[model samples]
Every structure is written in structure tokens, then in C-alpha cells.
Target: MGFATKKSKRWELQQLTWTFISIVMFVPLPVHIFPFVMLTQAKKGKIRSWYIAGIAFLLLELGLFASFVYFFGTISQAMLLTLTGSVTSYIIGNGLLLNRAKPYLQRLELAEIRPLAWIPTASSRNKIQQLPQAALDTPQLFIERLIHWRKEIDNRAIHQNIDKIIHLFQLLEQNDKMEAEKFLVRHATVVNVLMKYDEIENSRLYNSVTAESKKKLEDVIAKAAIAIEQEVTNQFKSGILDVSAETDVYIQSLKNRNLLNE
Candidate 1:
């Protein structure tokens, strides 16, 4: 099995084990809340596992109940416990399943909508070991960290931001703002690198980028982030910019004006 599939199966086993325990204890009280939560989350698969465990418990309880009644001539308090436990197990098991699935579900939805395109690819093994220790501003530092950890980042949102940043550079180049285009391209390379790190693993290089340094770097990027913003405003004022055009179309238009170096 794939790593993800194995991990998921392990998680399911854990959940089943706990659900079984709750069943034996006659306190699947979470059933009252988790079922409704599962419904709202719309993740029914997880709830199905809970039902599997609950049903198994119910079957076992029925066999035991029959034995007790046959020997003792009465359906004892165990019957009451079984009835209540069964009800709560189903309800709460659903809720627990949905709750556990929430983050994965949200990320899956986002991945569907934001199709991956033209993300610069490089291996973390190629990362440079040492960086110059000279004084550098926040944007430069942030970009440097990106370059240093280029192989470590793997977040979709960061790549999306890089896409926008690339588009902005193309826009600047089209507007004869070659200097700004070059500046951002040089600085934002790290942003792209950091964004493309492995999603499921911790990046040692990424972890090394300190928070205080990141905050300062963010401030710098924000201030000089996209010089194309001003150029876009100018184009709009001059009636030269097509506001309705999709970003890709505009990028194509700019590329047609000048060849973008790979």
C-alpha cells in the first residue's frame, strides 16, 4: 500500500479500537454529538467505520445477552446498558469520524479548485549548504531563505502566490519596468522554492528560517512585493489595461511582447 493509504488504515484501526472500548463501557455518549457533526461535515465514510465497530459490538452483546437470559431466567441490567450503548455508538462514531476527516477534506477541496501549473521544480538535495552572512534587508533575506530551502517547501498556497508573483513580473516587463521585474524575479525565487517543499514532511531548511527573521522579511516583501501594482494602476488610468482579461491571458500577452527567460 501507498504511505498515505497505510497511514489512513492505521488511523482507522485506532478509531475502531477506541469505539469498541466505548461500546463495552456502555458510554458511547459522544454518539449524541458526533453523528450530527458528521452529517454537517458530509464525510460519511468515516462514520461507516464507526458503524462497523458498533455493529460488531452489538452482535457480541446479543450473543452474551442470550447466554445470560438462558442461564439466569431473566434479561438483566446488561440489556439496558447494551441498548443505550448501541444508540450512542452509532451517533457519536459518525461525529468522531467527520471531525477527524475535516482538515483532509478541506485540503482536498482546495487542491481540486487550484489546479497546479508551471511550478518551478527542483530537488531539496540540490539546496546550497551555506549562505553569505552579510547584512541583508527582509525581502532579500526572505528570498535567500527560499533559495536555501527551495527543495523543502511544498505548500499549494505558497506556489499560488509565486504564480501571482511571476505574473506580476511579466506585467512589469510589459510596462517597460524592466528594473522592477528583474528585482522581484531575483528576490521571489526563494518564495517559489519554499512553497514547493514536501507537503507531508518537515523541512529542516524551512525549520531553520527563524520567525523573527521571517516577520522582517515579510514586511520587506509587502513593501516592495509587487511593483506591478503601480504599473497596473497606470495602465488602467491610460485605458490600456483590460481589467476583464484572465490572468493567464494577460501573462500570454506580456510574453508575446518579450521572451521570458527560463
Candidate 2:
């Protein structure tokens, strides 16, 4: 089997083991352990919805246990409770997953609609040539191409930075995350508007695009580009300053130990 298939099978086995423990034990201890495992998996972006339902089921079971020292009931009653609780938890988990899946599907659709110009390969030039002109002219494509033009930096670093920003946004469901998402949504809207304008100009509706509309679109693109450049410059400057300071401290320490000449 492929490595990815093997890894996925392993995860499936782990989840099954925990689930069996939770159901067979019919106790809060095994139930709680499964939820914690699911939560860790969710944080790693594996299973997204099970943790919340598992946690709810665990808490309910714990409350029942607190009321009764042991499951002082008939075997049939215990089995009934386990079956009901497990079914309820499964329904709740599936419901939450469906809710999240909607936005996730929409995002995937949007990404497909605005495909990147650069493929991670030596054949990127041919791929770009094959794309429609509208895709080539998008602000997002422009930014991606510009970053790719910098041969000195590894492209993976850019992806890593983007992942870090995404991780930060995922850390909370509060106002900060909302505000950050709002800013990104607004930026994406602006870029899409510009891309649509470009498409119209390139299409048979070129005569319909008024000069004023064209000017406004150009202005928006220019301002957005300037803002992006400034942000990148600031980040690079900050990194350089930090490195310089650290280097100076190291040099001073070496001089103090007579390990280096003035």
C-alpha cells in the first residue's frame, strides 16, 4: 500500500480502538479518553466534528455516574443506555461535520474558480501558457508569479508563512479571528472585482467598460499592490534587524572572551 493509505489505515484503527473502548466499558473514563484523542486529531485537522459530541456524551455519562456509584441497573438497561448514547453522539458529530463541510466546500469551489498560475514544477511556463488570459491577469496570479520570480527564496517558505497565518486565525473563535477573516474576505472581494473587470475588458463587452470604471479599478489594484509591498518590506526589515542585533551580541561575547580581534 501507499504510505498515505497506510497512515490513514493506522488512524482508522486507532479511532476504532478508542470507540470500542468507550462503548464496551460504558464508563466515563474510556468515554473521556476518546474525546481527548478526537480533540487532538481535530486540532491536527484530521477529524473535525467528533470531539464536541464525544465531549458532550462524556459529560452526560459522568453526571450519570456521579448520581450512581456504579451502573446499578439491569444488563439490558445498561446496553440500552450505551446504544442510545452512542447513536446520539454519532448524529451530533455528523450534524456538526455537515455544517463545517458547507463552508469548506464553498472555499474549495472558490479556489478552483481562481486557480493559481504557477504549478510547482520546472514546467510552470507551459502551464501558465495553457491557462486562460483572465486567470493570468488576476491580482492573486500576479502576486504568486511575483513571489515565484524571486529565485533566491524557497517557495515552500512562502507556503509556510501562509500556514502560520492560517494557524493563528484558527487559534480562536473570538473577535480577533473574525476581524482577521473580515479583512481577508474584503481583500479577496476587491481582487475578484478587479479580475471581473479585466475579464469584461478582454471579452466582447470591452466597449461597455466606461473610462471611469477602468480608472477606479486601476486605482484599487495599485493601492492593494502598494499595501502588500509595504507589508512585505516591513516584515523583511524586522527580520534583518533582529538578525543584526543577535549577530552583534554574539560578536561582543566573542571579543569579551578574546576569541576574536577588534
lDDT of 1 at 70: 53
Provide the lDDT at 169 for model 2.
30
Q: Please give the range of 10 consecutive residues that has the lowest summed lDDT in model 1.
A: 116-125
Question: The CA-based lDDT of model 2 is what?
Answer: 0.44
Clashing residue pairs for model 1: 30-92, 31-91, 31-92, 34-95, 146-190, 152-197, 153-196, 153-197, 154-197
Regions more than 4 Å wrong, model 2: 1-34, 41-54, 61-78, 101-215, 230-262
All candidates' lDDT scores?
0.42, 0.44
- TM-score for each candidate, following the candidate numbering: 0.26, 0.31
Candidate 1 lDDT, tens digit per residue, 1-262? 1122213555544434533453354443323333333333333332244344445545544554454455454466876665655565555564555444533332222233232221111121123223332332333233334333432344444434444554554554455554544455455534433433332235344444554444454444444445445655665455453544566687787788886542
RMSD of candidate 2 to the truth, in angstroms, is 14.4
Residue 211 in candidate 2 has what lDDT? 54
